[model samples]
Target: MKKVLLVFCLIAISTLGYSQISGGIKGGVNFANVDADGDPDGKTGYHVGAFLTVGAAGIFIQPELLYSFKGAEDFDLTYIEVPILLKKNFAKVLNVHLGPQFGFLTKAEADFGGGSQDIKDELKGMDLSAVVGAGLNLPGGLSAGLRYVLGLSDIADNDALPETKNRTFQIYVGYKLFGN
Candidate 1:
């Protein structure tokens, strides 16, 4: 995890030296679910973040910092997530995005009819995921997109529990802050 973060940072820093930079804030709705034994029900949550894009000529590297709420029914988890994406633009109105997302678990809770209990210690501290999406870049800096996040790492830390992974579908809107 540390090595991955270091590499991402180095790439971002190097790209900044020569690439054209643009960025914006975004927020969205998340449909989150867990892939595990018994098949938990999906939960609706939210995410808000900022993104920075560096590159030119229709290709770009975009790095995003986001606070995301994700979990299944009766369970809630909060994560600070960083996604480094390769974005390709087409026709000035359409784009495709693919990326690796790194998530750090910040909070976890489970409800068992009686009340909510903190279950943070039972989960892994870091999560790795892949993201794929498409977007429409509208006129005047506005944009809308959809993304699917597929977890690549097991989140359950307990040996006795079934392996658990996260899956999320996101719908979001954004407006470019500057640059081109």
Candidate 2:
């Protein structure tokens, strides 16, 4: 995990030296769920984040840092996630992106009727996911997009438990803070 993060950082830093840099802040709604032994009900959550784009000529490298709320049914999980994406633009108005996302768990809880219980210890600290999405770059540095996050690593900390992974669909709006 450390190595993967290190590589991503190195790539991002290297691109900054030659690319046309742009950045922004974004926030959105999340429809989250867990794919496990039994199909769990989806839950509503949210995410807020900042992003940096490094590149030009219709292709870019975009890296984002986000705080995401996710889970399913009675379970609630919070994560600080970093996604490094390859983005392609069309006609200066439409774009598509795909990437690998690394997530660090911050909190976990399960609500049963009257109260909630901490379940942080039962889950892994890190998660790996694949993200794919499309967006529209509007006038005045505004943008809107939709994405699907598919978990690739099992989140269960115990061998006795069935494999569990997070799944999320996100709808977001963003405004560029600086650069082109």
lDDT (C-alpha) at residue 48 in model 2: 100
Q: What is the TM-score of each candidate against the true structure?
A: 0.90, 0.89
Q: Which regions of candidate 1 are displaced past 4 Å?
A: 1-18
TM-score for candidate 2: 0.89
RMSD of 1: 5.5
* Alpha-carbon lDDT, every model: 0.95, 0.96
Candidate 2 local Cα displacement, residue 130, angstroms: 0.3
> Candidate 2, residues 39-133: lDDT per residue as tens digits?
98999999999999888688999999999999999899999999999999999999999999999999999998879999899999999999999
Which residue pairs in model 2 clash with each other? none
